[model samples]
Target: MKKYLPLLLVVALVLTIPGLNLDQVSAESVDDLNKQIKDLEKEQLELKEKQDGLESEKSETEKKIQENLNKQGTVKGEIESIDQQLDTTRANIQAKENEIAETNKEIDSLNNKIKELKEQIEELKEEIKKLQEKIEKREELLKDRLRTIQKNGGQMRYIEVLLGSSSFADFISRTAAVNIMMDQDKAIMETLKEDRITVETKKTEVEDNKTEVEDKKVEVEDKKVALESQKQELVALQGQLNNQMAEKETLMAELEHEHEELHEIELTLAEEQEVIRAEAEAKKKAIAMAERKKTELAQLNKKEPAANSGNPNGIFTHPAKARISSHFGMRYHPIFHENRLHAGVDFATSTGTPLLAPADGVVSKVGVVGGFGNAIFISHYINGQSYTTVSAHLSSMSVSPGQEVSEGQVIGATGNTGNSTGPHLHFEVHIGGYGNPVNPLPYLK
Candidate 1:
């Protein structure tokens, strides 16, 4: 304002009338200045309202930004947990598959062993059959010998043959030949009996071995079946993990969309703040012109006095009777377990607890606004400067836009909506302009 004052003074001098008395000129100047001051005051009111709206918007956006940051942290942690579980599930499935492969190989080996045992048993059966046949043939020959001895008077047959031979050498030859024949028959019978016993013992051993291999095959098959079931369970777990990851990703997308909205609001708020500053400067210049004209009029009259206007700036009061739940600025979030800006101070309260307006103001906004849930924005002028108040995370609001509200008026109700961990009232104050928040503790008292 001071930067443009010299120029304004120079312009005033150039516009002074040349052929009139100072009193006449002063009256004209005062009337024109009065009109200008009225226009500037009207414009000032509009600018102040705009400034409050933008400040409210910026505060809300910052709250949303903080909420998204906390949400992102939570979603990312869930995703990481799902990833870890997926790794474990996959490893378990691989192990089961490996076990199944080895079991199949063992089953194959058992089948081969069983087949070999069966072949060995068949060979032993063939040996036992041949031994039985040879024993039967030898028994048939011995039966014929016994029949001949009985027909020839049993023991006397050999003696009669010796007597009928009429020669000692012929008798002795017959005796030796008979003795050799009987001894050879006895040896053949003993050999056949021993071979049959040996073949039967070998068949028993082979049969036992076959039974053992078959049992092993059955056991291994059972193990494979159990392993398959385990693999299926692991696969099911993998499916559950995939679903969790998808849900987390969807939540992250929503948070990102919210962050984008906040970015747009921030940009718009910055531009509006600049506009408000320019309008304030214009209002300042208009006030200066009004003062200049009043001075001139007073000098001409020499019998005037000016009255001081009372300041309309109001004081702030507590909006609720709750304790501070969360403070403004950076802190570790409880749910997300990560550091993030809190943006607004949270007042601990039960759900549906009514909130009050801190000062006389006009409600600028009343609706659901992202993480703030049901919210209210109020515009106020304090000490000739613009400020905005934001109340968030409400279950219900009782006010509407452009509605006049007095100090301690019920505006909304507190709640645990959006990204909150519990029921609370989120309150913020943006003084002068927008963007960074100042500590609202002094005002909340």
Candidate 2:
């Protein structure tokens, strides 16, 4: 924030100054004016100090803003990196899902094969059961044949049948019958043995098929479990990546907000510095004006003889033979970009144009005067009124302070010097004192 110390000083200085009695002169008033001028100079020094402080503050704030920008840039890079991680995680998750799906398909296939194998085992069981039944029936028939042979005498019965036959032809028929009986018993035993072997083979095949299907199913199930675990891991990775992205984004937002705040502070500090600098300049000018007034008043008390007494109306002649380019008033300043007091009338002319004294008066000031460059001040006492004329922005000066100069006398040549835009004569008329400015056009002859 800008302090208005300079403004307060202006008010205090104005109040301290007593109204001048134009006809009388006093030494006490001049002393009081001198003390006020000293106070203004002191205040101007303080304003400059304050301006320096503001400049330092502004510089620090700008540094902080730059640091914040750097942090934001780093955060942006982190966020981009997180985005890439998220992309990779998402892709991995999709791949895991596909693998799980393939595992599930494999499991389904194994299950189908197990079911078919079970059906095949069941059919084999049925066949083994039928073969066992046939073997049991054949064993029963062999046992009956053995009982019949034991009941009747084995060889004697056969011999009796052969003896009862009437001829050899009858005996041969009995022998053929016995041979056919033996062959039938042998065939039954062989069939029972073959049925037992076939049952064992079918049972073994059923057990092997069941074991193979179960093994395949277990392998497929294990694969599914692994795929599911991997998928879960990928999902977790994706979540972590998302969290990182969100955190980076949040940090970036905070950094951006901080940058904005610091930037605003820097701008405010700069504005305050500008205000302080401008106030300091005003204070400096005030001191100079007060000093000039004090000198003029002191000179009046000495009762110095009038430098010239030719003009009756106390009007001034033109300071330069040129047209008025700018009039005295409040107007927009081209360099400062603000509405400020022009303070003087400007005469358009080329470099080295002769500048003349506007009135017959004593040269009160002749030197470089800050922004005014090589300047001249002439104090005029006419018709019981005090006036001071100022001619500034000179390329060369020919007059000296306290020298008596006549109206229309060449005191200097104008040029584009010290705060001027071009080579021209800047003329000002101050009434009663140095601070009280008035339009010189009205007083010009």
Best candidate, TM-score: 1
Give lDDT per model, in order: 0.69, 0.71
Q: What is the TM-score of each predicted model, taking all chains together?
A: 0.51, 0.49
Tell me the tens digit of each residue's lDDT in model 2 across 78-142. 88888888888888888888888888888888888888888888888787778778888999998
Task: Write one digit per residue (lDDT tens) for candidate 1, span 1-445.
Answer: 9666544643453354334344555656556555554544565676678778878878987887898889889888888989999998998999999999999999888889888888887887887788778777877876787798888888687677656765778778877876776687677777767777777787788888888888888899999899999999899999988998898888788778767656655754765465356435433432343243444433433422212212222245667777777788888644345796766788899998889887666666677665666777776644344466778888888887666666678888889776577888888887643334666775543
Residue 272 lDDT in candidate 1: 45
- Clashing residue pairs in candidate 2, if any? none
- Note each model's CA RMSD in angstroms: 13.4, 18.4
Relative to the true structure, candidate 1 has a C-alpha RMSD (angstroms) of 13.4
Q: For candidate 1, list the clashing residue pairs, or say none.
A: none
Task: Tell me how candidate 2 scores on lDDT.
Answer: 0.71
Clash totals for all models, in order? 0, 0
